[model samples]
Target: MKRLIPLILETLDRGLTRVNPLVAAALWHLRHPTRRGVLKACAALPLLFVLYVLVLIPFTPGIGDIRKAKIEQPARILSADGKLLAEFKPSNREWVKLKDISPNVVNALIATEDHRFYQHFGLDWRRTASAALHTFSGDRQGGSTITQQLARNLYPDEIGRAPTLTRKLKEAITAFKIEALYTKDEILETYLNTVPFLYNAYGIEMAARTYFDKSASELNVLESATLAGMLKGNSYYNPVLNPERALQRRNTVLAQMVKFGKLTPAAYQTLSKKPLRIDFERQTEPPGPAPHFAQQLRKWLAAWADRNDYNLYSDGLVVRTTIDSRLQTMATQAVILQGNQLQGIANAAWGSRAGCSNGKDLLATFLRETPDYRAAKDTGLSDDDALKRVSANRGLVQSVCESKTRVQADFLAMDPRNGQIRAWVGSRDFSQDPFDHVQQARRQPGSTFKPFVYAAAFEAGAKPSDTLLDQPVEIQLAGGEVWRPGDEDEPSERPITLRDGLAYSRNRITAQLMQTVGPNKVARLARAMGVRDSPLEAVPSLALGTSPVTLKEMVSAYGTIANLGGYVEPVMVTRIEDRNGEVLADFAPTPPQQELSADAA
Candidate 1:
């Protein structure tokens, strides 16, 4: 064993000599084992310490890029007039400067969180020592200063929340580094902006607006104390959820302020006695003007960002859309009014049918398709128990069905002159149904597609006064199949003018016109008019608008007719800007494509 030890030591000494000579020499001296050797090894300890310090110096964290520590800002979507349409804040925070926050808030925060905030470089040694002593004496407590907390908030993925000596050491180093990099006010500002408040609120600015319906600068002493108290543990002291505990914490902060000489004892007492007043209505995100259009713009922006290597969420972009706010509101109201009327008729017809009566069977069908029911079945719940469980959740199932079954509508209004989208209504409620029917969904246009067929007939040298038989017509397909087209009323052998056939949406007359012009030509004209995405087959049924097309495409096609002959591609976004107000890009309408002559259109 002694010989093996020498061999191991020799191998380590040789390896260490190539890496670190001081360490290798110490190891060699220890292996030799003499009184002089031991003395020499003791002498080399200071040199080893100096070498260690020198080695770590080059690898120290840099502090030049403080901007990298800034929290994410929400991107704003604006209308043509610069009115806010929607704001996409995934982090749900609004950054505010330290100077903007009330002095009362700053005082309350310093008193409660870190009394020696100004005196200490980064870590408060006196508080840390006291906290460590308390921990050793069995009352465990945290000794982190505001700087330490700020460091953790900025780099949570690195300095984690694990209660270990290693994590604490890293946190201390980061805190000291932060102090070296930024001023006290800067640290305070970053901390206030990064800290999480309860109810999904992050940062003092968001918390202030959420609870008080006022800006951080407008907060009074009591309000300031209330917000500061949440820094301890926001979930435990949430004003909305636990008012009593929040009140106690607020009083504690006020008391700390008195102790720190930031507030007088009489003022503290008076503030502590006041009741906590929070406006709950202000907590939720404000409803925007055009959500569907915003969502569609978000998708387009996302694709543009990917192609251009830009960030949509963090980079504070100002997206200027072509939406007219007044027109959008009117369009939304129209869709709601018309959709409700249609929904009432539909509900009266089908909502009270046999299987749908009382909605029990529908609820059961929905519940059976749920993951909870499947989990219950998988976990050995008997059929009877599963049924009981489903019965217990009948109200929830019913609510879900009602929400899903609400009548949806889509509307789009565009300027035929410039192809700028004036207004768009994608669905009844964007929260319930995010599906953009105008841009994303394809539905049968009914008789709305008749204009293209008539335009094709005119292009094929048929006049508006040209007459066609308004009778039932049967056409044979290539595969020996027959298609019989008819109008809503009884068949009439009377002739109708091409203009009247299109005006009344006459099916048989339009079918005869489609045959005269050729169905492929009609489809070609539809594409030229901006119905580009959905392919149209040259079938005889195309005359009666059997093919599915989006509302956006229909609007653009009709817009072409309204413009007399030229087709203009629809324009939504007008421009985009960066955080510093630099215009990144501007959008313009595509050059008009002539689909038909002026008289033909």
Candidate 2:
């Protein structure tokens, strides 16, 4: 700028030389001014520049509003073993506090970006002057301090990035406000958490994890230097993209550390020669092994966050669930192994003409149960047209006939003592079929309901060794209809023990037991043992498990027997914590209640 002062004096003499004789004569006289005039012009330039920058203070935003500026962070779901199940409403940033960050990262960043970070208020005048000198020689330098860079990052829209004098003025003013409002440590914390790195990574935390598969606190000196060096230009010094450039930049950062007294000269020499090794794996939100479970938990968590006044996507929360991944994986494997055989049997029964006795009728029934057929009917299509329309969609037809085409099952393992659900598999494929059969689908409990009837009878003073005649039972309804059960298997005409009746799933023996104990007693016992979600009809046919009940209810009911007649409601999430590792909520274990006598159970 000093070199341009004489040229500006000369330009005024040429452009206005022809315009006015007196102005050009005055300019010519000013061009050859005294040493005092030259010294005053040079002295007044910086003062004028300061006044011009001070005028931009009013235009600057409320940079001191640190009380409300929140960085959006994604919540995480983890299993009992601390394995990441999925990230809910995931983002590419993790806000790490200054304390959690390794000091090596701080030293590296200060050494490479701003050495006078602690000493400067907002700007380094000495470095700025040198940068100006370098710019004149065609070697540009970034004269903005860390505070200025952070001010730009915090309000990128307000402090525009275009290389204009006006933008720089606002940036400088905002940087001053930020420096006054926040501490040096706060600035560094926000700067490290806000800066962007390669691979959609933001913050030193994410950058460290993206390249090294570790948290910010776990970064070593060499790793910290490599990550800090990328702040110059993320893409240019990306370890995975350009290893040579990254290595060289890392060496420069190491040298800076040695110069700043953070690292010994001997250590720098040894560290600089080490190769850049990255664990670079693109991080994506995995559905985990419990997709259906996680999906259901997500809905519940949304409601929880709503009631608690927190944003599910932006507020960083760690939800610790009762789900054990080991048991979950084992249950998933069990379902796949067992469900395939059941599917084979179903396919062999329905896939061929000989297996399906009423193939046409069954296909018609399954087609009518589909939403596509109902949608076609709603659009004024007749039954034949709707059937034709549904059948035309091969994928839809296959899914509708998934009983034979796809094997779907639900498996839930719970710790009976505390009612903690350890594993939950709601379906074979949550992507293709999301219907959760565990608690959502209400189907007949089949012979599983017999245990409740037997328990009720046992509570009524009937022993397991007691014998009964295994014969078909009949009951006359109030509507004057005689009801007779059509048994799936023929019962032996001999007398059967109460234990054998339940072991063989003998409906006749169960019906006789129901008649002796009464239907109301059985329904009451079922509800008391955690089958309280739906109404259980007090009918005699309930002995055959005719009423529909969810798998969750049946499992809980069975768990009651295992718990020595004590019933406890199943628990899913054990606790929730905030981003700072503070316990926001802790869901204590639910106490168990006695439903029946231990001997009866």
Candidate 3:
């Protein structure tokens, strides 16, 4: 039995030696029964395991190519003041160099994320040992160095984020490779440029802009510490969404910075007392005074990019337009105020209508067409029950289409001298209706077309003082139909001066003048004045502005008169530039075409 036991020990020792020499030595000592030899072998085990890890690191896949990692940057649109109006970050990333980042942010990141960031060679052994002890004791803590986090970010598919020993070993191997390939500053730059902050913000630059409406370089100590705290749990520590939690986390980061000696205790106390002042009003999406203009710019840029072999979403081009932001704001406010007033007037008229006597029935019909009503019905409510529920909401009935009470208006202010569109408001509310009414909707200009007819008469050698008969006129049409054109409310038989007829928008006098100058001449002059989108028929009704014309066309035609009879095509965008500030194109004003004599206009 003694011989069999020794032989069994010898066979076990042989198997252990192939795997671990120190373990085999410990097993051999157990056979000899020496306490000293077993203790010595036990002491060598950790050193032997570390050596084994060091030997296996070079064989890891993609370890040698750490320096060749690439970062994707999204395209950004900036206003004239360099304010970010919009960003097309499909990957939600923007790369900012380490040099561009504030030192306060750097120090905060190191203190919160990795206290021994500078002291470590990719892996902090002391932190790793402490983390190991804590993990075994069922306490959760992380010991990943900044470089290790960077490695996982760069090669997530290769070095997974799974909290397993295998993943940890792979991560350690990749981190060592990154540290060997890049300098400390380079690693930090890559890490800051690659780490996700929250939401769609994927880097320090975007995080800075998203949270503070400022560049990463301009981050203060408090701001830096706040951002650093977000690394722990972004949603839980979001400065805008969870201010109290974020403030606590930020103070914790400040304490960490002080504990690590990155910040003085006095400085930490001062910063910690400060409030979490975040700019919540600054829009992270395409928001500004000119959302319609921004959308127009995006479409134009997309076509231009396709023709030029560029990417509108990834090339980071800077498009400069002629829109004046201040003017745009004023114009938008004016349109909204005027539209609401007009809507109120129309609603008052609607409320007095005989058809509105069936108010309850109309409200029910309107509510039935709404999505909210449908949603309530889908939740097991009957049709009548859903209608009753929707009707109980007072606001829903108030918004019903009482003769389409939602009045929309389009306003455009242009620089008449150069045809530059200074301000443009396409609708009362762009969010509710994205249709650009100014450039798209065709509506009759009513009496506004009188100016064009008068200008044609003046060009035909008729002076403003020339008298025209303001009487009802009956004329023959092309399809053998008789047409009678008259002024609004009543037809005047008095012979009025051309100036009086145009000023009063007298339709009878305009028709008489149109007959004298010839309808074809009037239509030709309207075309010359930049009314080119729709065709104008030479019928008698043309004198009273019966033709459908876009607001843009009317603005351009009127702008010609303001420009002293020169037709300059309206332009919105002035230039485009690449990311490196290289101008790709510069747009000059389209040369004006003289359409009328100044006196005639």
Which candidate tops TM-score? Answer: 1
Residue-wise C-alpha lDDT for candidate 1, range 321-360, written one tens digit per residue: 8998989989999988998887777667646422133335
Sort by lDDT, best first: 2, 1, 3
Model 3 alpha-carbon drift over 4 Å, by segment? 1-286, 352-403, 476-482, 518-520, 535-538
lDDT of 2 by residue, 300-368 (tens): 999999999987877789999999998989998888778877777877867652233223777778888
Q: Could you give candidate 3's per-residue lDDT for residues 1-601 as a string of tens digits? A: 9899889898998888999989998786688866877788899999988987877675565643564454343456655455455555555566778889999999999988998888889999999999999999999888999988888887787766678886888888888888887889999998888788776787888888889889999999999999999998888998888999999999999999899888899987788899899864332444457877777777777888889987676566787778776777789999999998887776676574322322456656767788889899999999888887877775665555543346789998888778888878889988787899888888888789888889998987899898976677887888999878765567666789999988887877887887787778888999999898888987777888899998888888998999889998888778888888899988888778999889987
Backbone clash tally (model 3): 0
User: Candidate 3 local accuracy as lDDT?
Assistant: 0.81
Query: Best candidate, lDDT-wise?
Result: 2
How are the candidates ranked when ordered by TM-score, highest leading? 1, 2, 3
TM-score, per-candidate, Cα-based: 0.65, 0.55, 0.55
Off by over 4 Å in 2: 1-70, 90-285, 352-405, 486-493
Whole-model lDDT, candidate 2?
Answer: 0.85
